[model samples]
Target: MHTPSHDWITTPLTAALLRGALDVERTAHGLLPHRLPARARAQFHDPQLAMAESQPSGVRLAFRTRATAIELDTLPTKRVYAGVPPRPDGVYDLVVDGRPAGSGSVAGGNTLTIDMTVGGAELTPGPVGTLRFAGLPDAEKDVEIWLPHDETTELVALRTDAPVEPAPDPGRPVWLHHGSSISHGSFAATPTTTWPALAASRGGVELINLGFGGSALLDPFTARALRDTPADLISVKIGINLVNADVMRLRAFTPAVHGFLDTIREGHPTAPLLVVSPLLCPIHEDTPGPSAPDFSRIAEGELRFKATGDPAERAAGKLTLTVIRDELARIVEQRRADDPHLHHLDGLALYGEQDAAELPLPDGLHPDAATHRRIGERFAALAFGEAGAFAQRN
Candidate 1:
């Protein structure tokens, strides 16, 4: 439906330029991103899994080129959660030679409508949209186009004025991280602006993110997917989704964590692994959940959430942020004796009460972009600083 100007060379979209995604599905019009490889994706049809994996949370297109102009055609599935303002179009970030160069947004694409009250959803497909960038330095340089973190983006065509080739690896350690919706980038400004992405940037490592929005429930298949991926460093942010989802009790949670870690160790036995507990979510602090949506302000286009479970339920093995944090700390400590590479990072260390007083969770659940930045900076210092867990030995 469009015409190319002046001898634009189109290169096949291959793994060389794409990072963070586990697999790509060849579609009639383009390629769909998948956090879970095809084998794992085929193991489950959970809608949460489908949405999370396809969102392309940390996926980006990177290459070395001399082109002053570039264009990318993609089909983005934008989500509109009921009772809230329509989410804005996803932003694609342009980074040149490690510096942010420019940004572009795709206007029209697919739309996925979600009704939290009834827990129903439907997708309406739209046409492919184009993202264009120009005014480059016209010198051989590394370029990256970070895809939208929240929207499901299917990359279609890539056109540039000059020849493009795979960017040379900088020989940086690859950091693989997994967590819940927060890590999946609920309110991050852009794909590369996610907390993990920020941390990875500060840490100076390649990133492979498996942060599945509501689907980071410590599933075995996800563990296997992480196990198979190559990583020099690993971190797993646990507890929030488990507590919020109200999926398992203490009995089930303990064994599940053990099994998840056990599976990951199978492939990355000696890799430095950090176990992260949930951040301070006020609603689920002492209270357990199945967090209920607050409809009182929904009419005003404000979406708020409140804990629905009882505080006293903790005595009955009901999970809460406090309970999960304590358990995760204890689990990591006990395991560290046998697994020297294992470490524990309390979520509070990333976003504790004092910080919350200043940068409160806007929705009473997810952190705003500012908090994400703080967490990322703190994490970078904690895990990648000289005395940090992932610090360079030399």
Candidate 2:
């Protein structure tokens, strides 16, 4: 799986090597990023990708490089499933320089191991281990590694023998977004296909996805995260998660949103900041969320979970997607006079009536991959197209 740069492979390390190298750290995790290998037997949206027998999930490391040498370093980590007996299965496929260099796993007795087949060395987890593939063929090569059903794995570090490419050209108007797990690519297949990534690719912009799973709570941390990040276009997909998690009351939600938007505006004064409401979730569409049912058996004896909110409570307008969407529209309208570039896009436009009817969400909640693609296409056209007014904004 290794291909050095054709003619450039013969060149010696130059001044770039003497200069400090830039490390491109791992971005998304296996299940989190929804990446799995073809051989991976079974997969699900839960945090871990469960595989039967020897099947495993795959992880790829890709970085644009102009460096002569590159190395990958990882530490053994395990995931603990909180089942009856606390099942812990830790196994990973280590691929470096495009070849299967080694395999790491938790032995039958739950003993951790790093087994290098060629050297017959079985090292346990104590000191950090290094798997180095030297003399990479070219100035740029992707070092991919795959991991199976493993618990919380930490990519310890990445080191380069030669200099790396300058950080992805920042000249492109970067779009920084913070949203729910859906934006984080819940069921979507690939990293690049996530709504945000897809929109960025189509819009020809750089993207920094701050879409933490179950974490976009009109919180100051998220607003500050966006405020600190540099971006030409900004968007916050709010509502679905708030209603799902049953986090805030309507009274508190409004001001919290205003504060969140205010914080972002401080950093990006004139940038077009699009506020997107939740896509239609049938269950939450009619019935306000904080869905309280033990849906475990429905998913095959899986653990039953209770979402926040009592429909009766929402009678008091505690928290509802409808309420959120209405208020978001109001918020943008109020600000439009003062802040001309601020805009709002209803989630329905992305996956509204027509799209929903065509691509019904598998569950009553999240849209499938096809729906995601449709959403991306529509978003690119409406929100970021050549005629998209955001492009004209300062």
Q: Which prediction has the highest lDDT against the true structure? A: 1
Off by over 4 Å in 2: 1-71, 75-153, 157-163, 167-170, 296-312, 387-389
Residue 167's lDDT within candidate 1 is 84
lDDT (Cα) of model 2: 0.56
lDDT of 2 by residue, 195-277 (tens): 76667767876566656555567767557657766678888999987887677788888889889999998888988899998
- Report the lDDT tens digits of candidate 1 across residue range 198-274: 99998889999999988889999999999999999999999988877899999899999999999999999999999
Worst 10 residues of 1 by lDDT: 385-394
lDDT of 2 at 149: 25
Worst 10 residues of 2 by lDDT: 15-24
* RMSD vs true structure, all candidates: 1.2, 11.1
- Candidate 1's TM-score: 0.98
